[model samples]
Target: MKTLQKITVILTIGLALSILVVFFTTSNAVSSGNETIIRFGHGAAESNERHLAVMKFKELVEEKSEGKMKVQVYPNEQLGSEAEMIESVTFNDLQMVAASAFSQYDQRISVFELPYLFDTYEQAWQVLDGEIGQEVAEPLLEDGLRVVAYFENGFRHVTSNKPIEEPEDLSGLKIRTPEFPLSISTFKAFGSNPTPMAFGELYMALQQGTVDAQENPIANTYASKFNEIQDYLSLTAHQYMPLPVAISEEFWRTLTSEEQEIIKSSASEAAQFHRDILRENEEEMISKLQDAGMTVIEPDRDKFREEADAVYEAYKNRFGEDFVNNILKAVK
Candidate 1:
């Protein structure tokens, strides 16, 4: 009878130990299995505002998802260039990218490239955060891309070897522009010789006189050290550029609705955070360019706006008046 009791006790203790082992093994498997990984790519260097926003996005997503999702950022074209990144994300080979030149893929995005579009940052934000952004972004879903947020590249300005105080001053000057039709068109309308080139080749293009000038946001100008090669920085504020945070439709479909909302909300918050940093540092950038021996020109903005009529007509013909009007109405 004592021997039987001893056997019973041993069996019970063995079962309890096995149960404990199973529980721990299952818990570890669950912990490791639930994590979803996102591979994000962007063209900006670490010092650029675009990359800074990307870092903020990583933080927000990780915090909100409670470690269920992990974001891995590849900056400075480590994964690929802007256009290449967009293509990868669209096919879902890459989960996400911060895309500045994605208009080449979807023409609807080209609307933001229109010259003299927004007079102020406030006006740009109103349109971007409202119906116009939604209207423009909606079509991207069909192309296997989802615009998670509209982040700022800020208002683009012109950097020249000489002062560009008026449209005539830009005449016949070789200006490097991103390989976008609207960007080329904008400079063409201003009577400049617009050369479409990759961003990586720009500094050399300017130095070698392959291009005489270029246009980008103030933050980009400073980050690229255009002040060293270029003599003048013109506050053209020609295009209030919006860099899209894009996710692949395939990857997006895999996410739960709750995960999607967390990502979307995180992107929007990061965008605002980026814009605030840019605004606070804009004057400082301009000052730094001046300190670096570049001439800063604040041209008659009205003069630049006046030349945009033909450009507007051309865009209206391409995108339709209704589409253009909707964007205009949003700012008001």
Candidate 2:
């Protein structure tokens, strides 16, 4: 009977040890299955559309992945300037980023920055969201980047401390432009001194009179409150700014095929959301700018177009006449 009791005791202890082992193993597996986190960076104020769109992307991506993925956003150059962020993506330091095509012009994405190339937002979207946009993404792929979507930044306008009623009014003025060669050339064509400065430094430069003027979308001007320091706004719409949403190729390749689909789907949905918001808010943005004491001027667009002619002539070889013609055709 004592022998039988010993066998029972031993069996009980063995059962307890087996249960403990399974419990610990299961706990470790659960911990190991936690979601991956992605950091998305951009160079815009929190209140700006670009920042808002990125937030929307985060929401969509997280929701679509059912908590299997997460996104953390860094706005207002907390990560760094646009150029810096792009480099971070290349080095796998940042997982994703959204930046103006102009900021990436030096990276050979300047093909999208040709002045007067896209006449309207729709045409620009068709070209950018379609095959040509995919082509533009090709170069970045070689640099360890993946383009997901293009968000419309809208048409850029000139805001100056002086009243600008015509192309001639731009003469001898120092205007702050993006550090893109094409942008500098565009302002130079109108005889303005183009100063390439980071967007974060622009407000101070204008306030201190370091620059006589700067150009941006009306919404951006209003959102940034640039109208407070500037007296005049010319509705030149000379350039169409588009923000390309990109991810680090290395990070992207690490994901499973299903995971990649989830991210791409979420990004595409967020892109459309941003476009819708811009369309709805455009008129209100213009009204807000006018209310802020900015004298809005409607100059003879043809004259401005005539001045921008030289930009094409100088860049035709680099951008190719056929490419330029394709853009014009898409807009038409």
User: TM-score, each model?
Assistant: 0.88, 0.85
lDDT of 2 by residue, 272-323 (tens): 8888888899888888888877788887878888899998888877667786
RMSD of 1: 10.1
How well does model 2 score by local distance difference test?
Answer: 0.81
Model 1 reaches what TM-score against the true structure?
A: 0.88
Number of the top TM-score candidate: 1
Please provide, for model 1 over 122-240, each residue's C-alpha lDDT reduced to its tens digit, 9 standing for 90 to 100: 88887888877888988888879899888888888999988899999999998998888888888898999999988888999899989999999998899889988999999989887
